[model samples]
Target: MGGPVERPVPEDSAPEQSAADVAPVTVGQGSVDSPSGVERHGMFGVAGSGDTSGFGGLVREPWTAPGAQRPYGSYFDEIVDGLYEAYADAAAAITKVVVERNELTLHIAREHLIGVATALRNDPSLRFELCSSVSGVDYLGSTHRLHSVAHLTSMTYRRRVRLEVSVSVDDPHLPSLTGLYPGTDWQERETYDMFGIIYDGHPSLTRILMPDDWDGHPQRKDYPLGGVPIQYKGATIPPPDERRAYK
Candidate 1:
């Protein structure tokens, strides 16, 4: 009933592209077990058969055995709460003191890092004996932003906990815990090298791996994946997408 459609391109111009040039696609979640399983997603236009298990095999969850028994309310608990409360009262910028899954997590304003770390390390009852590890996680596309996770273990109380501190990419600065826990020296350096988190009080903040002239932090989520373009000497070298580097 309608009039015939007319082509707009001139004879010498490029051919008119069809809908196939930009086909609509369905996108499924990354997990194979999800109910909304089979769907195509992303710009590459790859389709999904909804199969995540390799070669039709089932995916097995890792085994976690039960742990040994430990005493309740170790001496740390007696004044731990009170000591933290005191520090929170003295420091206005300390944001939160949370105990979740038998672990203590502290959140503080970046500017108050020095005072808070000092309080936690020096507080007699809540004396966090050791700084086990310092690590940073880049959440480039995540809603919560970048989070720097610090793990601290108390040798005297034999308890372990994680302290999560966050800062925006625009202004990522926190006091170095090296002064409070000397063990943080190497760990902080690693975090700095990987995530570009600045430890304001760190003694030596330098690139531990890549050359100092490198432009960006390699471990950040937004960092580009880079590798040399390979030219095979004799045998065919499959492109990066087809080859399994690990194998």
Candidate 2:
């Protein structure tokens, strides 16, 4: 299963790449009625009338990386093809493939994240053996507000890819990748601690940064802004904007 698959010499290595080597990977046609990008209204995206930024008149269209078209350039096509070869159900597992800003991201269903990740890692052609980082994104107002993203590297092929999964806030659950990549243990915990994502199969998915009694996940887009009082060593401390005693 770990056999080495020859990589087409990248354009940089050779004067040019052959037509077959640069062929577009046709896996993962786009889905979802709406783009998964975040939508914003007003300068500060203010819900209430506190338009302190004063640029409130400006409205920004959601800039999203829509499902990518064929021939995802670079080694991306190879990676996609390899994943399909390794994973029997690649089509069902992946929601969409987004290649934008010179990067490739595979949005997988949360239920199939592990299997897809496994295929990426074990397949010699795909060889995304290392899960270097795991993090989260909260796209407020989207149907699936929480997104768990993982970055992987293929040491053998000098390639990298991103795997992302989204779940609704009401049921924010995703399988932990610690069993696959031990380093993901703390990264997943930190994501959970900051974003409140519950990693279902995590062995010890406790609060890694926030105190156990902390009121809410601090990093979520919907988390309250820092304007409340804080208790430190049994003494009251004013919020940042209200603080003036240091003078």
Candidate 3:
């Protein structure tokens, strides 16, 4: 791989983020023999087989075909179907299914999260053994905003997929996956810290960074960058009227 991956700061045309509100990124040390595979944690990993059938350069599987009646049925077909079957009520919380970059995402409600996770993990076919990553995205002004996405990997087939779930600000109570994937502890805390999402069963939910007294979630678009009336060295500092303009 290249040099240590640096945390990416958005350009002037990108969404406005505070100097302090940088996205979290961890760089890995590794090398690649071929461009077709990606190295995870310094190990070369191959992409799944079914991921090849798509239009143009697009890789991920499409949700539905022209005449297919029973949803999508392929390598992930049984796994997804079994999940929805086992937890029909819990899975019903899922509002949408999106396929992008060879990943199957489940947009679910917060309340049914734990049940849905448990069902996914326990089911034989969809043995989503590891909860690879859990991160939150702030869709600020977008229609269905304030979303949290969880990426799960399966060791059995050496495949990877994504599951996305969302909740509004008023009720951001997602059932914690810490019990199922113990690693969720830190990710959940980070999500709570930056996005103010509530993980109901998180063993210990606290701010990973920033002072506990901080007023608002920095990741939120509506949250102001800094408080007014800057005072430095016991003197009122002059304010600049320079506002961010995008092209």
**Best-performing candidate as measured by TM-score:** 2
Instruction: Kindly list the per-residue Cα lDDT of model 1 for residues 12-63, writing each as its tens digit.
Output: 4221222223211122111101111122233232235443424333333322
Ranking by lDDT: 2, 3, 1
Stretches of candidate 2 off by over 4 Å are: 1-56, 228-247
- How do the residues 198-243 of candidate 2 rate in per-residue lDDT, one tens digit apiece? 8877888899888888888888877756654456665655444335
Candidate 1's C-alpha runs over 4 A off are 1-80, 88-101, 142-144, 227-247
**What tens-digit string does per-residue lDDT give for candidate 3 at 1-247?**
2322333322431212221232111111111000111112211122343423342243332122122234544455665676778676743445455554445666555445666676666555566779989988766543335667798886755556666655557666666778778888899888889999877757899988768887778877666654356456655433222232110
**Full candidate order by TM-score, most accurate first:** 2, 3, 1
Query: What is the model-wide C-alpha lDDT for candidate 2?
Result: 0.73
Residue pairs of candidate 2 with colliding backbone atoms: 24-71
Work out candidate 3's RMSD over C-alphas.
19.1
Assess every candidate by TM-score. 0.58, 0.75, 0.61
Global CA lDDT computed for model 3: 0.57
Cα displacement (Å) at residue 123, model 3: 1.2
Predicted structure 3: clash tally: 1
Error of 3 at 108 (Å): 1.5
- Angstrom error of the Cα, residue 213, model 1: value is 2.1
